[model samples]
Target: MSRIAYVNGRYVAQRDACVNIEDRGYQFGDGIYEVVHLYDGRFIDADLHLARLERSVKEIRLGMPMPLASLKLVLAEVARRNRVSEGLLYMQVGRGVARRDHAFPNTPVPVSLVVTVRRVPPYPSSLDGWSMSAITHPDLRWARRDIKSVNLLPNVLARQAAREAGAGEAILFDPATSMVTEGAATSFWIVDAEGSIRIPPLGPTILPGCTRAAMLAEMAEHGMRAEERPFSLDELAKAREAFITSATSFVKPVLAVDGKPVGDGKPGPVARRLFEIFARHVKGAPRNALQ
Candidate 1:
């Protein structure tokens, strides 16, 4: 079956969907995007995702294409039309089409909105024996990494580098300080020797991840405290365990980094426990529970 997409306030076949060539998003990558995960036809962390979307749009100085309520309805309709029960909903808002120019168009123009949905396999029941390897790369992204912008060349390159190196992710670190920033598409976390969760503090170098926030809340609920402070590459190497969080991969364990084993070269107890806790949190809570 052909998939459907919402483009510029119209629902159309995905293949037939198109935006103007002069659209700032297409021309200069001036846009922001958000992705929400769906489980059993319900949006997981819809409120948080919407909040982040708004924040990103504001950060980029672009007007919202539609009101929040209308956007939510559009997303729901797209998901329904595509029959996406367990999948992802992606939304992109651009500065609108105008003559090819580096600066923002002088005249006011309506922001462009596009949304698409696709099915994804359910989360694994157990990462018991499964693990992912990651490679570290120099953080070469713009300073405003906090914004969820459409510009992702550096991230794309880093991810490709990881793929070529037979790894699933690339953990980016600052060249100046060697402080770990984040993954190409995921938020990084480590379990320290004292069994405490350590994550980098909010800064311009890292995007504020919704899944990372949810994981922190889950950790708190389970009586585990997370430290939000910068950890260096040396620190990560000696950490007891490590993992990454994202809208897609909830709590994935990282057994190795740069071909070196982490924590006995296996998924550790902390990561396993957190994964179970996160799974339960997502499954047991109602769609609006977080709202």
Candidate 2:
């Protein structure tokens, strides 16, 4: 089936969707984006995704193209038009078109909005034979990684490096501190030797991942011990297991790092259990349960 896209104020063929060349998102990368997961024709964690989009829009000093309520409707329509029952919905908001200039336009301009959807494989029911790997790379992104902006050149480069290295993801670390920040496009987590789940604290150094937050809440609901402390490269090397989370990847186990096996080079029990918890949470967890 041909894909459909919502561009600005109208729905059009995905191939025909276009924005002004002078749009700030195209010229200066002055925009934010969100990727929402669709499962069984229902949006997973819609509240969290929209909340983060709102936060990102505010941080970038860009106006929302329309009320979030209206944006949700657009996203639903886009998904429906594409006949995507299990896929990802991508949304981007830009600071609108303007004359070539570094400064914001002297006159108000309506923000640019785009929404599209694409299909993905169904969620896995087990990690019995699944294998994924990662390689360490320097975090060369800006200090405002907290914002989900479109400035992703550094991430693109890092992910490309990982691809060339025959790895599935790039685990990024601070060059100066030798501390693990996150993956190029996913939240990084580890199961330490003592069996504690560890994720780096949220700050300017990393994006506040919606999947990470939901996973943490699920863990908490089960009375699991989770720490929000930064883990160094040395600590990661010694981890019992490692994994990466994102809207699309969900809770994926990283069986190896830098070509070395992690805890027998297999998916650990902790990761499997976490994956099960997250999968169940996505299917039917209460909205208030996502604290």
Tens digits of per-residue lDDT, candidate 1, 1-291, equal 899999998999999999999899998999999988888788888888889989999987888998888888899999989988899899999999999889889998999999999999986889875579999999999999999999999999999999999999999999999999999999999987767789999988889999998888888888988999899999999989999999988889998999999889888888889889988878877653223
What is the Cα-based TM-score of model 2? 0.97
Clashing pairs in 1: none
Off by over 4 Å in 2: 286-291
Give the clashing pairs for model 2. none
Taking every candidate in turn, the Cα RMSD to the unseen true structure, in Å, is 1.3, 1.9
Cα lDDT of model 2 by residue, 1-291, tens digit: 678999989999988889888999999998999998988888888888999999999987888889867877888889889999899899999999999899999998999999999999887878876659999999999999999999999999999999999999999999999999999999999988777889999999989999998888888899887899999999999999999999988899999999998888889988988888988987776662222
